[model samples]
Target: MTIRTAVMAALLGAALTGSAVAQSGGDVGGVWQTQAGDANVRVSKCGTQLCGVIVSLRDKIDPRTGQPAIDDKNPDPKLATRSMIGVHLFFGMKPTGANTWSGQIYNADDGKYYASNVALMGPGTLKVEGCVGALCGGENWSRVSR
Candidate 1:
């Protein structure tokens, strides 16, 4: 009877520890540097989902204007003059998997929004994919400190 009680307690403890690990497995909140090191985005909870904003740029000056870059390529006239800083790269990113989120990603370089998904490849790596029609490509983004 004593041995059986001890075994049951051990099993229960293991199960509880596993649950704690599971809870931390899906956390994707942090700053991530783009594969090209062109930009860094800060991702966090928007409402119920997640969103990322442009926090910095490697080249702050736009050669065309010889000043800080703006979203001149954006189709909307109102947004054309908007500054590149604080631009929403992705919003309404819904959880598609335990370690992935799917949504649209804004590309300021081309002034287009592509179907995209982000997944955690490891503790310090994230895979970001963008698709145009049938052609899809992705790159690994490294997690960065705030």
Candidate 2:
């Protein structure tokens, strides 16, 4: 093949490879349902990082009071009265590797922040892990359609 043809072929191959890499990395922006099926979080880009907000909850009422749930567990008294819905629980997640991100996650249940990592296991599956001190736990979340 002529030199020109060879260079063109190489460029085209590089472009295809780049596209595949991007697709394999996956997009984290979407709605994901927690493993317990208790909540659905909407993940989206916040500046250059990713953030997730509670969009829906299986139980909206506080069992003890029969009123809408609040972030009463939050350590900060000023924030404790805020509604749980629309609360940003995942923050500043930066891409760490292909299909994976690292950041911090706030556990409203216990009112604590933990080092967190998330990975897209598949087109519809996500693995989320949170570590506090030395102990760590994780759960698999599924993509929510609409």
| Over 4 Å off, model 2 | 1-24
Please estimate how well model 2 matches the true structure, expressed as its whole-model Cα lDDT: 0.85
Query: Each candidate: how many clashes?
Result: 0, 0
Clashing pairs in 1: none
Tens digit of per-residue lDDT, candidate 2, span 55-114:
989999989989999999999999999999999988778766566778899999999999
Model 1 lDDT per residue over 1-146, tens place: 69999999998887666544433455567899999999988877665456889889888999878999899889999998998999998855766555677788898978899999877788788888888987889999888963
Best by TM-score: 2
